[model samples]
Target: REVELRLEQANHARQEAAAALGAVMERRRMLEDRLRVVRGELQSTVVRPVDPAHVMRLQVIEDQSVQALKVVRTHLGTLRDRQRALRREAGDAGARLATARTRLEELRNAAEIARQEISAVAVEIAELRVRGESVAEGLRRDADASVEEALEVPRPDVDEDLESLLASHEAELRRLGPVNPLAAQEYRDLQERYDFLAAQLDDLSSSRAELRKVIAALDERIVEEFTAAFQEVARYFEEYFGVLFPGGKGRLRLVDGSDPLTSGVEVEAMPLGKKVSRLSLLSGGERSLAALAFLFSVFRARPGPFYVLDEVEAALDDANLRRFLRLVDRFRERAQLLIVTHQQQTMEVADILYGVTLERGGSSQVLSRRIRERSQPA
Candidate 1:
């Protein structure tokens, strides 16, 4: 019985050992999977071994870089301060230059006034010299002798006091009347002003001549352009008018044939069986058609990328509307046309349609639809 109990205990211990071994095997498998995932990640990553010497070197480099950054910041601040100082110096220089210019102008004005005064004094001196010469000539003529003898009269022995001499000079000055001291200066000023005005007048006269020539040239150019355009549009107008109203004669006449620049235009339209001297004499539809013909004639003469016509054919009848639509058809391949109208016939000929409609909530919405191509009459 003792041996059996010992054998049973041995068997239980072997079973526990087997279970532990299985658990260890499972744990090894999980570890192997985790290792494989880590190896894959390690293959993609770049790993460098960290050395104490390299770490120390990088720390030194960072310190140097911080120092260099500080130096550069200091240099930048110094440069900014220099720039501000330079700007201030430049401003001071500009102010000094302006003040110098103002002072120079004032000096120039003073010099001009001084020069004018000097000229007036010189003129007065010349007049006095001329009078002295005339008096000397008169004395020579009256004495009937040489000029030396005429002035050789000896003075009597008398005491000519300084006060008496000054009084006599003052009395002579008083007899000369109110002498204008600024007469010569005023004359110089007037002369300069007259010269300036004369120059201005000459410039004005030349400008007037140039302006007249320009006007003549412009008038000529206008006549040439107007004549050529009128002839081309008139031809197109005749062609379109015949198309709109078969067997009708239409013409555009200038009210003043002599001058196309300032002339008004008159439209004469004669329908197939009627004679109309003026546009107003035609019926409403006929008048609209005639106007469209003229407008399209102008369009033909001057081609453009697109055209906008707002209710142009609103007064046209069905027959005239067809003619107008046919006219619009001729320009479709060359340009885009935007027509605003309530006519279904007009919309039927369009390549696109845009309409505004109200939704159930009373909000407005814009809708766009492309139209199908329709066969056009040649």
Candidate 2:
């Protein structure tokens, strides 16, 4: 819902930019015509050679015309720039609108699916309640015979015992308020539902046992998989760390050596000639490089289709930025990297660069450049 609201706002801003761009274009056209008219007037005035006495007057008029044309041209240039900016703003807003719409549709479909499932369960509940009431009504009408009379043996002694027990509690029964006309039916329906629930609970208990067995198996598999992956990632981490920081010695360790599955992981790096044992003790640039190495290590262990980063190298200096990009380049061989950053070194190394800028009126515009095309940044 919030996303929808934001989409509405973005659309509104886009429309406003469109309108503003049209106005600016119209104003620029008018200014251009005015400049042409001013030029024509100056031309007509100086078409013939002026006499000595009137030359000063003609010159004065020409100077004023030239100044007016300069002012008009300046205004036209400003309007044209404004129009370009507004157009870009509208384009960016449209992109946001499209993305928001897609996300909204996905959310709506998910909610609808859940509603359908709940509605189906509710329908089943209603059907079961009705069938239970029907059975209860039939029993109430044939009070002399039990539903189990055919299956169960006759027992007058047990019946007499139950009658005696009922007689003993008859005073308490009489102390109760008036009975409901549909109490028996309601009770029967509740009992039916309870029985259904009990059966469901038994099924659930069976499922739970199966799930526990599955979980135990999964735990064993996870330990095997995690241990293998951790070893690979740690190997990569150390190798990349050394390359990133020439003489650095970095190691990844599980807090509990015996239980890698549930243990916490620690990364310690001794950079170059430093005696630091923990990552936190390293300088900002050192830490950034260390983190980048660790990230690349995980990617090497289990690569994905693409990796996304936001200002990941913000703390790195130029030298470390180069190292970070180098690692990114190596990882890029296996996975596409999408990075959001303002660092020049990061931008320069990008195969395709995407950027967002604020136009004159404080509206955002999105643009992209491809390294393959040798496109220059503006």
Candidate 3:
């Protein structure tokens, strides 16, 4: 009985190995067929093979892009520094301008007071002259004398308090402070400086407005590009979802429609024959398929040279695995796909195979095979 059991186990192992080999052979045949079709298409279009210099040109372009990005970052730093300096200067200029205006006003007030005092003094001197002329005319008329004799008449004595009054006036003049000799010239200088600062402030204001306009334009452009890309991905998601889950509905909507640049995307999926409204409500396999559909949608929207997928169909059953393979096959001609999976169906769609195994007390070993190069079954 033990010998029979051992034989059964050995047979089972052999069968599993044979199945794996058959899967690899099937993958090889599919790749061969695809290669032939691609060649025929290329010949019909008269398209030449890929140029070896293409990679070198791409590398040069990438290097140039890096240099350009560095230059832009440096220029942005310089602009920020200049903006800070201008803000400091604007504050200083404004404070200085206010002080100059206040000084100019004080000078003007002092000038006006001095002019009033001088006018009053002139009026008093004119009155005194008129009184003296009147007294001389009276003496000439009363004495009936000649012009020279009028001067000989005796005049009244001067007021005894005249010296005291003159002393009082001198004291009052001393009470008023001495004026600034350079006040007028200093006022003119302040006015010129204020005009210059005002012009500078206007220029800074205009520059700020231009910067704001540029920022607004950049924001608008970002919104436009993001919305367009989002819409494309959403459309592709819906189409791919239908293929993966027949009769299913899928959609992507922005969390904030008014601001696409900062908004979040919401994914909604419903598998066939299910009324599910939330992703958490779906089974593990259903969620996996939905996620794959969304992922491939993005891939189609922005294709790269190659993609690496690791066990993406681990939760999928045989039917769903076939659907996943179909989706991958659609991209076969456009880009290279490297799939790492344990599923026999998934492995049966590859053009190359890589296997890893561990030896008893040694290290891990990696085995590689070109599936399309195999001539016969193992």
Candidate 4:
């Protein structure tokens, strides 16, 4: 049991660590992507000119590009560090899982052996009980035969001298009031033995009952503890979901009659006061918004170093798109957001923009541009 518990705890920790690592990876990828974009943009603007007088301006651009390259290099180093941390955590989780599996197998083998031994003992006990009952029956039959024989048997007559002696003894007993002390003493002894045996049987029964109750209580406690653990995890998920779907409300509930092993999450959305049945039912724009909300909620509930969102705003209308950008803006202080989009509005809202375009011969080129100012509100 302890091994199983340790394994479960290790797995939970591993999941949380893995989530953190994923965020970090996303951040790193975004940085690399941005770097690529900046490089591409610089290349597009620095096409070789036929005029020599543009040389100074070209040198200035090259210097700026060099500086940008240095910044990307530094970001790369940070990304490498994040990647290393994630790998280390994953390795530790794998090792722990291996150890848990080994121990669980050993326990299973021991339990199987115990079960076999118990089965053998039960069979032996049943056989012994059957033999004991047969012996008891035989003894009872013999005792009945002996009682009948005693009743039918005749007593031998006393001799004349013994009869005279007996007559004298009988006259003496009459004078002593016919007291029989031996019979009374035997009755008292039998009563004492019966009482002792009855007391011992009662004690044995009570002990067995108490042990069963204790085992039952332990089983209930185990269930309660597990339920509480599950609730804690559910609570975290709920809070995250709420954040992801702002202006909307949703919750997580354990489905009735559903096995935990087979259970899955049910997303309930009350967008604009109408309950949504399936995510697919939502429009393309709504789906994009919902997906983003879900992702954000997960991130908020279990925070990571950063997040990556690829082409996340492609389907949003202008208003919804701005809302999405604003959502990203809110998380800047808590987590770095890496966004990939082709929309100009999205690019306008970016702290840094990386563009990817195909060069003349199908080679992929990257460009980076910083948003100098926010576009005027429409």
Candidate 5:
């Protein structure tokens, strides 16, 4: 009975130790997994505190602890792989960051240089403007003084000298009047001849005065007509430019010469939102369009019987050519348009097409054809 009781107690003790060992093995496994996770997080820049107390708290049988240590060793392998990948990424990012920082410094230096250059240019421009104003003022003062001097100079009196000579001749003739009988007859004949000559001269003077008045009236009429026509042409120019540039605008002013007899008209073309003067400052196509607009405006105002346009669309593009054709169609009511162009669009709008062909013999011949179909004679 005593031996059986001792055997039963030893069996219970062995079973309890085995159960405790199993529990300790499970805890050791959990700690190994936690260590692997922490090591991985640390490689990825995640901070983790080491728990020596938790590792010491793990109570396992000797063999179980040995097996848990083997599991922890496997974590080192994965941790090494993670560390390698993280190091490569960090190295590439550092290189990129260094390049970006260098570029930022260079841009800052360039911006500072540009700012200094702009400040210097602004100072120079201000000084030049002031000097230019002073020079212009000095020139104007000199011009004024020269004009005053010219006005104060004396001039010869041609009309007064002629009147004095004529009066002296009349006095001499009167003094020799009614002397002797034969002398008086001769004197009377001479006086009659002189009176006839004087009457003829007076008629000539009156005729000259009338001619001068007629010329003055004609000049005034011509000036009025040209001024009105010029204004109308300017209005057409404005409309045409507005159509071409859409939202943009332009102005056409007629500049007159200083001398009336030698005076001529000049076109002052000013584009909207531009500071430059003259059409020459524009691009090639723009200059062509501006010239075309001016010519069209003149034609609209004057309205010739027929126009002779010679290759005027050479510089125009497809879009601009369309606009030009539209303008021509609008003007067709006022005048007949005869456009010469090699473009298909211009050929399409022709009423009577004339083709100039060079034959094999090198001679050019004009071939005229009516574009519209004609009905056959019945």
Candidate 6:
């Protein structure tokens, strides 16, 4: 039945493959006809005059038709190969089905023979079980007689020599001590200590690994945050520095290259033509301006509630002094900027001011002043 079923499935598959092959062949024929027509059209001259553009268009159409024909032929060849393979597979499957049917018939005949043999063996087993106790006693006597005959047989002389050698080996083993009375307790104590030490070592190793992992995670977080802040600050620093010195450039970089977590940063600035490598290299006014730029850069990157600057623009010239006031004005829009400057430009931009003055007694007094604005005409 299984062989028949396989044969039926094989036939169905062959029919399906044949149908598909016919469809593929029909499609291939149609494509070939279309391609032939296109090539004939390309070779034929039109009644109108031929120009370069017309020739080019015909060339393109011919090329496309040739490509399409090659694709169709390639698919046709693939289908032919597939059809051949399917025919071969169907033939092989038929042969296998025939062989399997023969094998099944043989197995069925063998099963019939085995059934008869099993029935006979079952009857024989039942008859043997029904035999009386006398038969059992007779079987026991026969077994005893066989055992006695086996015992009566003499063994070879080499066996005694082997037995003596075995005795000598036993004597040699006995010469080594049977037990170590005191050593046992010492061994127990040593084993206990070893187990305790091993367990403690394992626990310590795991704890150390966990600690290292935690340290690595923390270090990674710190580096990520620091790098992000550094980039933002560097960008703002360049902007502020450019505004402070219109034609110059400034850069902020880490002093240490390899490790950002344990590194210091330095600023390099060039004002129009002067290259200032260090903060100390600048004049007092330039130094003040650079410091203020750096501070505002940090503030722009990470804004705060308020800021307090005490005469920070005191050393700047009128030009840089105006630039400084611009930065102050911009920052005041985003934060509460408190300036204690003696510069008139700083005072001019101030929305409100709290003036601090010293009394003769050496104590400082704080006073608040709201600058009144001029009213607009309606």
lDDT of 2: 0.58
Q: On residues 93-165, what C-alpha lDDT tens digit does candidate 6 reach at each position? A: 5565556546555555554554565555555545544542335455558765454454444644654654555
Give the residue spans of candidate 5 off by over 4 A.
1-181, 256-264, 271-273, 348-354, 358-378
**Candidate 1 positional error at 23, Å:** 99
Clashes of each: 0, 0, 0, 8, 0, 0
Task: Record all residue pairs in model 3 with backbone atoms less than 3 Å apart, i.e. clashing.
Answer: none
lDDT of 3 at 236: 92
Q: Write the per-residue lDDT of candidate 2 for residues 65-184, one digit (tens) a residue.
A: 344434444544453454444345444544544565465555556555545655655565566557555665566567654556522434336446545544544544454434454634
Best by TM-score: 3
Cα lDDT computed for each candidate against the true fold: 0.58, 0.58, 0.59, 0.50, 0.52, 0.58
Give TM-scores for every candidate, taking all chains together and pairing residue i with residue i. Answer: 0.50, 0.42, 0.57, 0.35, 0.44, 0.48
Question: What tens digits encode model 5's per-residue C-alpha lDDT throughout 1-378?
Answer: 232233334334334433433443454456445544433322231111212222112112222433444453344334334334433433443454445446555655655555565555556556655765565566558765453454444533643554455455445445534333353353344334334433433443353344345434534543464456557867987887766655456665534433222233444555557766566687666666666676667666656566667777778888777877777666666666667678998887777788888999899999987776423200
Residue runs of model 6 more than 4 Å from their true location after superposition: 1-182, 262-264, 273-280, 357-365, 372-378
At residue 354, give the lDDT of candidate 6.
73
Models, CA RMSD each: 43.1, 32.9, 25.1, 28.2, 59.9, 32.7
The TM-score of candidate 6 is: 0.48
Query: On a 0 to 1 TM-score scale, where does candidate 2 land against the true structure?
Result: 0.42
User: Which of 3 and 4 is the better model by TM-score?
Assistant: 3
By lDDT, the best candidate is 3
